[model samples]
Every structure is written in structure tokens, then in C-alpha cells.
Target: CSNGGLEGANNGKITVPAGVTSFTITTPTVDDDLKEDTEAYSISVGGVDATGTILDNEEDIEVSSVTSDTQTEGTSLVHTVTLSGEAEAAKEYDFTFNNGTVEDEDIGTLQFSNGVTYDASTGKITVPAGVTSFTITTPTVDDDLKEDTEAYSISVGGVD
Candidate 1:
């Protein structure tokens, strides 16, 4: 997980072991004042301690492609990370982020911004502008048995 207390900071690299098939990375949502810009942050994943070469050859997972839309000025974004390879079932992986910073804080929390919308049908929260980030810490179980229970704990940082 990245973007918690340390915004615009880098924590360095995380090592994933071999035989692991999938993993999830969590990033904290940011709440910030609207007047600021140029929030700098970065999250990187690497296979430093793996028994075999990391497949894909990509240095780190690209979060921008998966959750770019959610990083808007005043909205909370949730993104799920999954591996794309064949390995043992139920294997686990861990990812860590390089420290960084977000410029705005007042815009992060829902109460201060335009508010959020929950779509039961799509299972998504729509955040408005001026907010740096939003995260769902706990997710209610879906009506369908096929869905898994999910929870999120997020924090946003900026000028109050």
C-alpha cells in the first residue's frame, strides 16, 4: 500500500517470491484543498527475490492504466490488481509503493466535496471534482454468491 502518511515520497522496491500466481496492491485515497496542484507520487513493484525470472519482464505494475480515471481532482478511485499467468491457485503476492505526495487535501473527503454516488448495479463510487482521492475501506457483500467480500481503508492528504 502507498500514499498513506507519506505523500510524494518513495519507499523503494518490494520482492515477490516465485510460485505466486496473483497479487493485489492498495493505494490510499487523498483529500486535498482545491487551490493546489502538482501532487507527485509513485508506486513500483519488482521481482527482487523470486526464484525464477519475473515473467512479463515489466519492472512494475502500471497502475495508471487500470485506475487512471479514479485519480481525478475530487473523486475516489478503486482498482483491483490481478496477475496474468499460470500458477498455483490461491497464491498470494505483495506489492509496495515508492513514497510520494499529493498537493490537495480539502478536496479529498466526500463530506467536503460534491459528494459521491454508489451504483449497486456496477459496484462503483463516483467522486466529484476538487477531491484528490477516495477509497472504500469496507465493501458490503454482493448479493451474488460468486462475488468475494472486499474492504478498503483510504486516506487523503492536502491543505485543510
Candidate 2:
């Protein structure tokens, strides 16, 4: 009997004819961004048998192997996170950023009640006070500042 006609067997049991060899299962691409390392994501691959049967218990596969393209860098007031990786095609992925801190050098002294604004467009920091030395540890990107970090100097008599 041919491969297709085997399903019509009277006993509901069919024997395979010799020469039919191997089948392959293709893995789908996954894109994910995790804020913490312990996060898990599920991936599914279609094209299963008519009965939705999967070989080797391989249904609803778990994702493995994640890589990050960039890291967060800046002072205490702001930080930036750049990321890239392989994700499933035509699918949307959500990447979470955990609150983390980085080391920043003191450019000038930051006085109490002084205002500081980070410009995302030019990647520069504006301070409203004259600081002898100030360390920016957790700088974040804003609409004015695009890059991760910026440079600025403080004058003793600068206007607040």
C-alpha cells in the first residue's frame, strides 16, 4: 500500500514500508529582552501533524540563548540602555529595563535645591548651580539627550 492509503487499513494499525527515512523540525526565531536573568519566555512552532502531535515532546518550546548588544552607562542621575537581538519575525517583543546604577565622575559640585536637566538631543547636562565637584551616577536619556552620557562645566556664579 502507498503512504497515504495506509490510514484506511482495517485493523487501524499500519506498517511502514521500507525506505521512508527522516523528518526534520524547523525551529522558529525568538526575540526577547529580559530585565532580569530569571525571566522565561515560551515559543511555539506550527506545522505539526493533523492530530497536533509533536515528536520527542517538543511542543511549546522554551527559549534559550539570549544576548545583549549594549549596556547602560552614565552618571547617577541618568542612564541609557541600548539593546539588540534575534526575535521571531513579525512578532512584537517587550524588553524591560531594571533599575541599575553606574559609576560617575564629579564634574563639579552640585548644590542643594539646584535643578539639573538632561538634554537627549545633544547629550548634554544642564545644571542650575555652581558645583565644586559633582558626580553623576544614574543619568537617564531624555528628549534633549540622545546618547548615554554628556559633558558640562559649572561656573561659580552661574545662574540657578
Candidate 3:
């Protein structure tokens, strides 16, 4: 009965009141920070077994920009991404970089830090476990053409 993160006394005698055909049984559980799937277990009483589930309470992965300062051409636009909580395991996040007003050639090579990698085929970023924060730097090309100020964006998509 202790399977699936369920903890507490496995067996105990409960005294049902006279003329009472029903009663309530409370099962204690252990709290953890790991993000896990739903767990299940069963309890038997008076030759009857009842099933129960332990719902996961861990928070989902969240991404927020820690820094997004404007950079001049020939420099880099730095973006720091942070998670809501520490990762229990390696997680992959899908992201996209869009050149709003700038051409594709205006953007330079993308760089990632804090043990993260960008998969060109999948367009996803793999963040290693125990990493709560990382940075992405996008360099801008310095061209001789005199054009208006251009804009770009980095967006986070699905997380797995």
C-alpha cells in the first residue's frame, strides 16, 4: 500500500460507530519537489478494496526574461531566461527567433550558455538538470546601408 509516493501506516484498526455503515479513512502522503506523473494505490477494509490517486503538486516550468537591453549594431542583444523552479530532470523547451523588421542576414550566430544547447533540426533548447537560469545572445550585423532601426524577438513555445 505504500507504492506511488504514498506513505503512512499501512494497516490499522478503525472502530466504526454503532449502526454506522460508512466511515472515512485518511491517508497521509509525502511531499516532494520532483515533477512526476499521477500515482495510484489501493486500500482494503473489511474485505473491500478502494482505489486512490496521488495528484502531483509540483509546479510547471516557467520562462521569463531576466534581461532584454537594446544593443547597437555590431553588438549583441543579451536575453536571460529563468525558470520558476529548479529542474528535477533535463527538460527541453521549444523557442523561435523572429526578425521583425530586420532581414535574415542582419542576424548573426546565436549563442547559448549555462549548459544549454540549441537543436537546429528540432528548433528546441535543451536545458540540463539543476540549471535554473541561462542566457541567449544574438549578435547584429553592422552594415554600411543606412536604414531605420530594426526590431527582433525571441519567444518560448512548448516545453517538454
**How well is each residue in 66-136 modelled by candidate 1, as lDDT tens digits?**
22223422334443322232222122222222112332321332222224455446534444433333333
lDDT of each: 0.32, 0.30, 0.77
Error of 1 at 53 (Å): 24
Worst 10 residues of 1 by lDDT: 60-69
Error of 3 at 160 (Å): 18
Candidates ranked by TM-score: 3, 1, 2
lDDT for model 2, on a 0 to 1 scale?
0.30
**Every model's TM-score:** 0.20, 0.17, 0.64
Instruction: Give the TM-score (vs. native) of candidate 1.
Output: 0.20
Clashes of 3: 0
Q: Which ten residues in a row have the lowest lDDT in candidate 2?
A: 86-95
Give per-residue lDDT, candidate 1, residue 70.
31
**Per-model root-mean-square deviation over C-alphas:** 24.2, 18.1, 7.1
